[model samples]
Target chain A: MGALSWAALSLPAKPPGLAKASLDRLGESGVAHPVTAVLLNYRGYDTLLEVGVLLLALAGAWSLGRGEQPAENPQSRPLLLSLLRVLLPMLLLAAGHLLWIGAFAPGGAFQGGALLGGALVLLILGGLARRALKRERCLRAGLALGVLVFAGIAAVTMALTGGLLQYPPGAGGALILVIETAAMVSIGLALGLLYLGGQPPEGARRSLLATPPDHA
Target chain B: MIWRSFDWFLLLAIVGLGWRSLNDRDLFRAVIQFIAFGLLAAVAWVRLRAPDVALAEAAVGSGLTGALLLSALARMRRREQQAVPPRTEASE
Candidate 1:
């Protein structure tokens, strides 16, 4: 019965003309990639909400329980450490390149941010970013920065153009870049934290008391 | 004709990997299959002309998800090892 019903249902031969409409108005966003323009300009609200949801997920994870500290001693793996030393800078450069080329290519904040998170995960695995991660305040700020900046832009643009996330004339590209940059940072931190699985260890407080004060 | 054949092969690989990932008895092997499935699916997305989705699928779908699953498995194994033996004598 189910197979017969499924076979009886005929789908449309063509999709709705949403893509045509998007392409027709693509110049307003000033980006060569229609996907990028749609994501950052035409329907930025979705991305904003997505970032917020990621932040909420991290928050919920932190609230639920603490992540177990990695059992392996990173110092034992000299080869891995050396490899990371060579790989880290390349990852950073590539991530930045991806973000920049997003204006004209298939890369963007999410792709770049994933690379950044991968870098963070490498540092964690190598025990390189322990001190930096210890700065919980700084980490929290980075996690929230994307959503805050995106929401702020929405409010500002709403006031300027009288519509939420509607960019003022000639400033759409620049505004999108700003939002993407901030979102990249936040997304990277959030993904890394999600992998970490729970609240970071508080043992860093004791270490801080024993050592001299240092900036993040 | 060759390209058409390749697409069919790709489709079969994707479906086979997905099926194996879901039904495999070994957790680790299942996760590996899942990652491979994600990678192939990303390729399929590219073949369909959605490079943006392809990039995301490769990065977040396969890479990050594979790492997360491996770590979660490790944690589960550790917990299971710690919990297997009961401590009855000390409780009184």
Candidate 2:
């Protein structure tokens, strides 16, 4: 049966159908990177839906219960703290570089966002950005910003071009950049909050504010 | 070729780590194996000429997932310890 099926299935020759079309029409997306073009222009709806799904997953995780703090964690080791001090800035720089290079290279919002998320996770583990992260209002807004911006762009483009996410003339590059920037921020915050496991307690906010920033 | 052999090794390592992680009795060890699996899978993605995927696999799949798993493992252990009664000499 396996051999029969293999024989029955005809393999595509040279470039596949969509690949040929995509290569021919690559300039229409205006993104130098083929992957970026497909992700943010050719099949942007999927990417938009993906960001929404990620936000939904974070929402589901948050709804579970209040997050419990790690007990007796030696996250404040002098060695780890020092390492974080050096690593944080470099990681943030690399994330920004990745986000910018996505237009012409094999990097994009997801990769950059993941790196940003890693940095955020490090900040959380080191307990350095406790006060910043505690800004629930800002965090919530940032968390929803990706999908909001992406969908907003889609709607705007739809109104202008008569199709969802269809870029208006020469605006594909800038619009993708805007959407990706918002997505990177949202993804990083969402991942950091996911590591937090659930919604933090109300009292913990007051306590964190009282403690000195360098206490960790 | 040397590259072909390396690819075979990579494949073996990925499969072995994946299987071991799934079946391991110890959660901590399993998570470590899972992380190793993810890293190897990232290498495989790179070999397949998908650098974008390779980046995501390494950053999100290995790094974030591993951190999350370890955090959850630590929490589970802490909760279990809290639930169990401490045995004193008198109780014994």
Candidate 3:
């Protein structure tokens, strides 16, 4: 029931002690990013709430899985597709580097992993999404297993640390890395799973949804 | 600023993909376009100093979304296949 509420602090050039501490950790002076510490440091209650919000969103997505399917459309040329095919992966990897750099600079796990996942999404949209799924039961197991393992770890942390998710100050960076990484995988899996369930057939959901009921 | 050169190109791709996604002749392409838009948006995030948000955008926005969309496509394909039953000659 820990709601992780992040403190609102101006990422201006100079600020209060908390801001300074945060920047020092990232090895930067500016504080443009939301100080997760304020949320994580002092607001254990809110972090749990944030997890609840995520859970709600996940629930909503699952609820939306009743629509028909969409028909295919023509896409851009082969050359452009080829170029993107080459470039997207590189962009994602760079994002990961940025995340690691954020430990002593700016850019952290969330940003880095997002970029990587984004690239994967791009590849999938380009008509390659199917290959990744493989229709294998093991893949499904992996998806659920990753989530379970993360949850188990977090629970263990709560037991050992006397808080829902407090890592030692020394291991702060490592903790963030672990959480964000797991988040990336789980989020990607969830998104992909939703798509599989929610898309409508040839705008069937849209058309049906767009047209209201008759005045009987 | 390595992102500079790729910025405009990705932007164009996003717009093109998004527009096509929303109003293409085929419903399926639209879903794909939406996924592309998410990826490009991630690039924009990387440039904009919000790695965390970008990660959310990419994975949640595109990855899972694309998978969901593809499944939807498969379902539609199944429906289509069902509609056109093979070998329906007059039963003598």
Candidate 4:
């Protein structure tokens, strides 16, 4: 039955269900990336709400693991440490490239930010960077930055254009870039912290020189 | 014809990995299987001509989610060990 259904399915003759006008106006929308234009310009409100949803997820995770300190694994090998030193910077570069190319290609804030988040997780696993409890304020601020920046832009754009997030004709691209950059940073930090499972205690630095666990 | 065969193979791998992960008794093995599923899903997205979704699936779907699952697993293991202290051979 499944094979019959699969065989029956075929691509449409004329690329069904896309608004031709929207495709034509994609370039004029101030971003060459059609997906970006659609996500941040045509449907900016939805993107803003999505960022809020990410924040809500983080909030829920934090509450669930309240007052729990992340357990340290001190058994990171030197080889892994050296590898990460080389790899982390490369990942950051790739992320930056993705963020930049997102203006004209398939990359975007979410993809780039996720790469950064992955790098952060790698750093944590390698014991190079620790999530400190004392830095909760900083973490909180970073988490909120994306939504705040997005909402601020929405309000400002509303004041200027008399409609929410309606960018001025010539200024749309720059505004979207600004919003994407802020969103990328916030998303990266939020995701990385989420992987920690709980807040780290103040002054918990797992140094490279630290002794490995006996099992290692 | 070759491309169609490859697509079928990819589809089978995805299904097989998903089923294995769902049924795996070892939580760690399940997490690894799930990560593999995510990567294959990203490849499927790319084949579908949506590079944007593919990049997202590879990055957030596979990488970050895998890390989250592993950390949660670690925490769970720690809790389990604490709850069930080792019964020494002498005691047994």
- In TM-score terms, which candidate is top? 1
Error of 3 at A202 (Å): 15
Ranking by TM-score: 1, 2, 4, 3
Residue ranges of candidate 3 with Cα displaced over 4 Å: A1-52, A66-77, A134-150, A191-216, B1-92
Q: Which stretches of candidate 2 lie over 4 Å from their true place?
A: A1-17, A71-76, A203-216, B86-92
Write candidate 2's Cα lDDT for B1-92 as tens digits: 99999999999999899999999998899999999999999999999999999999999999999999998888888778876676453488
What local lDDT score does residue A97 receive in model 1, on the 0 to 100 scale?
Answer: 91
Q: lDDT per residue, candidate 3, A1-216, as tens digits?
A: 123322233345454556556555542212234444443334434644544454456557546654432323316557647877788778667866765555444455445544555565455556555445544344345445435545665687788777666655466555655654555455444443444453222222334347544633
Of 1 and 2, the candidate ahead on DockQ is 2
User: For candidate 2, lDDT tens digit of each residue in A41-77?
Assistant: 9999999999999899888987998775543344647
Q: Write the per-residue lDDT of candidate 1 for residues B1-92, one digit (tens) a residue.
A: 99999999999999999999999999999999999999999999999999988988898889888888887898899888877665443454
Candidate No. with top DockQ: 2
Candidate order by DockQ, decreasing, is: 2, 4, 1, 3
Quote each prediction's TM-score: 0.91, 0.88, 0.49, 0.86
Ranking of models by lDDT: 1, 2, 4, 3
The CAPRI quality class of candidate 4 comes to high
CA displacement after TM-score superposition, residue A54 of candidate 2 (Å): 1.0
**Minimal lDDT window, size 10, model 3 chain B:** B83-92
